[model samples]
Target: MAKKDYYKILNLSRDASQTDVKKSYRRFARKYHPDVNPGDDIAVQRFKEVKEAYEVLSNPHLRDQYDTYGRTDLDSGDVSHGTTYGGADSVEVNNDVFETDVDSDIYEVSTGEDPYSQPGGGPEPGSDLSFELTINFENAVYGAEREINVPTFRICEACSGSGSAPGTKTAECKTCQGTGQVFERDRYSGEMSLVQCKACYGRGKIIQTPCMRCNGNGSFQTYEKILIKIPPGVDNGSRLRIHGKGTPGVRGGPPGDLYIVIKIKDHEIFERHGNEILCEAFITFPQAVFGTEIEVPTLDGTAKMKIPPETQPGTIFRLRGKGIVDMHTGARGDQHVKISIVVPKNLSERQRGLLYKYARTTGEL
Candidate 1:
């Protein structure tokens, strides 16, 4: 079957930029995420397709491979094809981008087709992977570098991802006579149907001595440590891309990317909206009655704001340029401090008399 074009799946042009790909993914994922479309099988399936398309299109290496080869076979990095493996291709929209049931689509399959064969030395692009990184609110505001260990696949160093032992080579598969697929002639319909050759798993070749390190799969699981930088003004759900840090590509293909999904912890005193911050401040009756300058907490540092005389509770004061920095533009937002008047809990006799006297003087007792 032919593979679905990832650019079409993401509603993108062949020349779309990385930023465009990201924007499209976010817009589509929000509409089709399982949480947004509960119990809808079609929506669930579409969401998965959208995710798969994004996984391929968002990464530079993978997108290039998918474009050049017309397939996204990251595993074992087989880049020697210009046509999709099977005639089994599907539609543009509402297509199943991730062909999990068909291993030949995502991985190597034995083939007699020389044009599609991946020689022992060609670079196979790696699969793109995602990780969710939880960070403190302050770190998101101030920006910080963090080290993380990602559990993913890397090309086998021992076999160099060829699936054969060192100094050895793969032999042509015999089941399909070097053809990666088998054909059956139906008498009644007079139809010829093609099926993947199981002998060499459609690779049209067999590795007599598989690499012991990777067991012929050409990749292994390991944890990789990477340092990622968090940009200032990043809030929860911000996504950052780390190129060439994901699953390693096949044979000698370039590594895939690691997408970092940000999750900022809730702050104790402040809540963020876009680049702005909202916080609550408490002032005594005297402070509100006589206009005073008070220190207010900001993401940067303490800032002084004036409370006008006769200030009312629930009034919001704007502290310009004291909120989070704009991630893209580098501009700053204002901080909104909501005022809450604090009344004395326990009144002494002298305090109660003073308040009454003061109220009477103001003609409000």
Candidate 2:
């Protein structure tokens, strides 16, 4: 096979930073990992290529050699001193292939560059936020609108998130030449790598005069009151999404999304399974003996059900379309009611006499 360009294989520029290399490696590895793309020959081959590229590019000495002499340095060159490259397919040596101090089981761990870093100017998207919302069972069955307070970062109105004091200007970061990144050579291996400039916090500019209210942070933490519309048929552990309601992004990036996790409180009268509702209703002995109509509680309102003659206890009756509705299909599930016979505990004198007389007439007069 012809030699592949390590940078091209990783989709990185020649001057990409160590963090960018690691981040790209993680992204490509995760997408093409054998476990993720099971039984796919192409993915398997691509995963091998990514791992090989990362192993070579991640090491300072090896990367420097590869940059100067290309892949030929692995065979024989001035840059091949302590660097080693395995076969075209796999990690051949038993020693550590990665020298970045990251986990050896790279696939199991999340290793990437700062998600908030923006390469082409502007800020990266804010991190996604999660909030658990506890709601009543009725609200979960029938939709409800609830007002909630979420703690998050909001843009600093004092300086409009620019971090500079009013009437002051931002100066270009000299350390990174307005790129927000600095290149440094390793002391031992003399290899070059990119790192975020500490002075600008990767902003490519410096706030000469810090904002007094936000202290140059560009945002502050405060409570935001938002009305969340809970849809019907949402169960416990269900998640509702509200876009652009999360933390304020850095610089001019778009805000992140807010995820509302539903925690349905237990109901006193009903137990829900998927879209179906289950409950138990007690009927009098006379009602069970002779056919009678009884009222049962449903999510909507009271529903009348007919109890058949000689109906035994523990008989389950289903009322169609009386349960929760499906969120996607709009189809409703059935409400199942289990029957319980309630026998009379105490009898009046007339009632006892009537029962005794009836028994005597039937057999032992």
Candidate 3:
């Protein structure tokens, strides 16, 4: 393999600060990490490249030596005497690998960079699923509750949430000595660091005899019915929240919420805009010319509406407090019905003759 340029690999300038180099290293590491890529060969190699770049650029003295004298100083060229203690021999090592009094505390622990990757960080909440449920236009105007049969896991009856069998106890966390932390002591920097215990994972205990029902996973797979509440006057995309209705959380955590989105089915005779309702009713030409009583649809039973004499086409009749009710407030909205005159599609011979005679008598076109 060709020797790679660490600076170019990290996309840092020659005069870039140490922090800049570290940030670049972290960015590339997150992208090319083996954990993120799983079985990707190219990503694995790129991960190695990012690690190597950080290994060189993270150290101040090594970066300076590489910048000034190039790669020659990294191998051999010059030697320096450093302090020794406790009968240790005077060892000649590159300043980059040797730590002074002020190195960061993160290097004292394991090589893993991510913080949330401890063993205790397991899957918790169940996923939130969504599906469309349509309600009747009237039912939507009025709130309702329906018992929906949805697929979701509930608490396991066999082992509860503990995973261990009944009458059994869990073992103490051996990795952190029940404190749930790994104490790291660095002789080179003389600083103590604490990290989450990778073994017992801050739980301070472990199950001895695993539950046969849940396989010590502390959760079971099953389906249960849940009731969904639909509020009145809930338009499309109106979301109703149901607490503790989502998937069960892991390790005795509370379950998440399930949101029921409200959608009103289209009414056959009415169209709604906001809280108001609009409908178009067809009337005969005679009905518009002469006053007549007509039955109109409303939330209540059909009611008779009076049409004034000489009523023209495209005239709207307002029915106060007859429209859909406001969901937030109990106030009802008025319904507007526009009347349009209908003309006969096919004219009879007598009708044509009468219309022609009337046009001649009135001198109208």
Candidate with top lDDT is: 2
C-alpha lDDT values of all predictions: 0.69, 0.71, 0.62
The sequence of per-residue lDDT tens digits that candidate 2 reaches over residues 1-365 is 35578899999965454567888999999999999988999999999999989987775445644543355445543433544332111212112221222111211111123533764347666654666777777777775666667777878999988888989988898888888888879899999988778878777888899999999988888877776666666677665545566667766776755656677778899999989999999998778989789999998779999989989999999999998876534589999999998877689999889878987998966
Best by TM-score: 1
Question: What are the TM-scores, per candidate, against the unseen true structure?
Answer: 0.58, 0.56, 0.50
lDDT tens readout by residue for model 1, 1-365: 35776677778855454556887898899989899988999988889889989987764546644543456674433434533221112111112222222111111111112222343345546655666677777777776666667776767789877789988978888787767777877889989977667786555778989999889988788776666666666677665556666667665666755666677778899998988999999999999989899999987679989899999899999999898876645688999999999989899999999999999999996
Off by over 4 Å in 1: 1-123, 152-154, 166-209, 356-365
Model 1 RMSD in Å is: 14.7
Looking at model 2, report the run of 10 residues with the lowest lDDT sum.
Answer: 102-111
lDDT of 1: 0.69
- Displacement of the residue 216 alpha carbon in candidate 1, Å: 2.0
Candidate 3 matches the true fold with a TM-score of 0.50
Off by over 4 Å in 2: 1-122, 157-210, 350-365
Error of 2 at 9 (Å): 27
